[model samples]
Target: MADLSVAFVGKKLRSPIGVASHAVLNEGLSGTEKETEQLKAYSDLGVGFVHTPFICPEEEHPKDAPPGWKFQGIRSREPFMMEGLLVATEARRIMCRLNAGLNMIENLKENLPDDVAVIANMIGPGADPDGWAEHCKSAEEAGADIIEMNVSCPLPASEAKAVQEYSTGEMSEAAGSLLGDSLQLLLPVVKAVVEECSIPVGVKLTPETGFPRIIGFAEGIRNAGAKFISGINAPITVSPPDIYKNGQGKWPGMTTNPICAALGPWDRFLLYRNLGTISLFVPEIELAGIGGLVEPEHVVEAMMLGARVCEFSSGILWKGTDIIKESLEFLETYMDRQGYNSIEEIIGKGVKYIVPVEQVDWRQEDFIATVDDRLCTRCGRCANNICKARTLEENPLRIVIDSRYCIGCGLCQAICPEHAVSIVEQKHPVIGISVDE
Candidate 1:
């Protein structure tokens, strides 16, 4: 049997899989009971941790806002298989009032399994470092095992009407991706929280903070005393308008297109960016993977790339609570099959292999493409579209590969509907050959 528990921020998680912070599903005007019930359901399913939906510092929801239950409204569309999931909503929808959020944390701590942890996902007053610090401290006192500063939510910044109008840049008071992207704003808040709280503190980062720049952001967060970085909050995008409906939005019951948060299978690469870049550049800090992870295999993929724990938000919406159970089972079977005895053995296993492309040895001369005749259906899909290496030989109605011209690029192998093409090693390896030849 494999050990599924993993250490995150000096605490042990029963499993690396946890529920990502997302909109709470509330049944009525008094939303706390339903929220607590939903969380308890996740707890019963054996999640390692659960994040309280993005909690704000205000004691009550803004009076101008709609009811808490209504504010949790979300709209989603799956345009195609490749688009994965596109989720859109006004930022107010996911906000949880401070008193309600703290109570939920207290309730969870009292009732959750001993191995389960509670991460308070907090969004504080952006401009006030002291205020942010105070909010974190309150969650700590309220029994949150960890504090995840959710500074990368997409909806807040996505609400901005025009990007071209501001050469100087626009800042929102909402304190999400805007805070995570700007170091001057983020570092002070992180420092204040670390000073005020005794527990592990982490930042959930924005996907907007892309590579090279992400390196600087990670360095700054680590310097300011954050223990881990979890991401990425869904990236902002507009769903394609319905061409037949006079460019109306695809969201059901809404005619106008609103800038929404994108989720689902497409996010794995962005999640890998956070995992790979931070793991390689900022080894002192930890990572929790959260974006586009929709399947059991994605959990292991995230771990190998240095995610200590992985959370499923959109995945849960797509696959349901069963994703957690499936992931835990998958982890155990995968670890044992791979000869990994513990979760620690899998963490950061792939990081060392991620090198600059310039440093990769292509070794063209040692490999060549080969066609397996036994499996070939003579489809000619590869011969017409693939490369100069393959051509249809008419007599037997088969595709033939000229070894001299074959570069082993594997395009044919990848596109082969019949799985007849393969890249294989050369029996007599040639030395000192340029790729162009």
Candidate 2:
């Protein structure tokens, strides 16, 4: 049998698969004995590490409802929101009671088998750097093997100190937020925690504009003493939906007030993109590729793209605990079929396949786009969403393509709600210099 074991965050994981931190382990909010038992089950299933939530003691929690929750005004009145707070608080209390000093590292070391590593995930505003630093110390003292600094949450309190701005489609803002002045603002917080904690430190980052920004963040984190990097949290976010209706007035859900973002299928491509970039720049630090990983194929693909570890959250939510065993079995089979005995051999092999533009076959020219006008209500939603040329006119129940500005990127074709857009080869000037030039 091939040895699937791999080193991550300064320890060897029997397998690269691990459970990601989410609502499941927030024992205070979802505090059911069943959940802690589930975590032990995951460890038994060969999970490399199990990450616990950011620890905030009851005292630190709002004296009334909670600081942010009280200020938001919904937690006191809404049962569901208050229930979430209760879970968070209770989970913290449980962790503190279980581990002396409320240290996650100690708790895992005491409760879990020796083979399974325990990681602590901590998030805080930049203004509360000292608070985050103290949390890291507590986790380390408790016996955590690794510390994961979460710097990309989209929630308001979490967002206040977020290292990177949530991407809102503008490439400049997205790129600048992760790399430019913002990184300078974030480095100190990360540095402080890493210095305070004895264990290896890793930073979780969101998918920004592209690879350059991703590379920039990885480099900065490493410079700040981060031992590893976890890439591409929750790409392709949507606007929060309205959760309440007051006659004609509508209100958003309490969680949606700050915007609750989660990862989904649209993020699969981003996982590969960010890891590919990191493989080239920060090859020494272990990389955890996350977001949109659902099946065994995703695990194999992530490894090929230079991810030493892959974090899973949504897959468990959609498929349940059994998916863990299924994913491991599939990975083993995939490794066997490829005649590879170890993951390191295959890591970054796919990166070599990503060729430069000039090397690509430009002569093939087999572009296909089919637009269905039947679904096209002519609401101009597709045109408004993509068409920069303003060639799409309303009222005639049809879309007219302006061949000049359409670079054949197919933005209009893909965004069409009514399926009324199709791409046919029209002679258009090839713009700018090729990579060969």
Q: What lDDT score belongs to each candidate, Candidate 1 first? A: 0.80, 0.60
- C-alpha lDDT of residue 159 in model 2: 36
lDDT of 1 by residue, 124-192 (tens): 875468989998999999999999998898877666642421223344355577677777777988999
Name the weakest run of 10 consecutive residues (lDDT summed) in model 2.
83-92
lDDT string, candidate 2, 1-437, tens digits:
77778877668778888888654444533232545566677888878777775444232422343222211111334223321111111222222222322443454577787657787765543334565677677777767788877665333313333333433221121121232225655677778888888889888776654667777777888888989877665532333334453222112223433322445455678777878778876777778877778777888788888888887876776678777889888878878887988977877788776656788755434432334555556666656756554344646556555434555566766666555666655433232211111
Which candidate gets the maximum lDDT versus the true structure? 1
Cα-based RMSD of the predictions, in order? 4.4, 10.1
Instruction: Please list all clashing residue pairs in model 1, or write none if there are none.
Output: 71-93, 151-176
Off by over 4 Å in 1: 24-30, 63-82, 161-172, 428-437
- Measured against the true structure, the TM-scores of the candidates, in listed sequence, are 0.90, 0.66
Candidate 1 yields a Cα-based lDDT of: 0.80
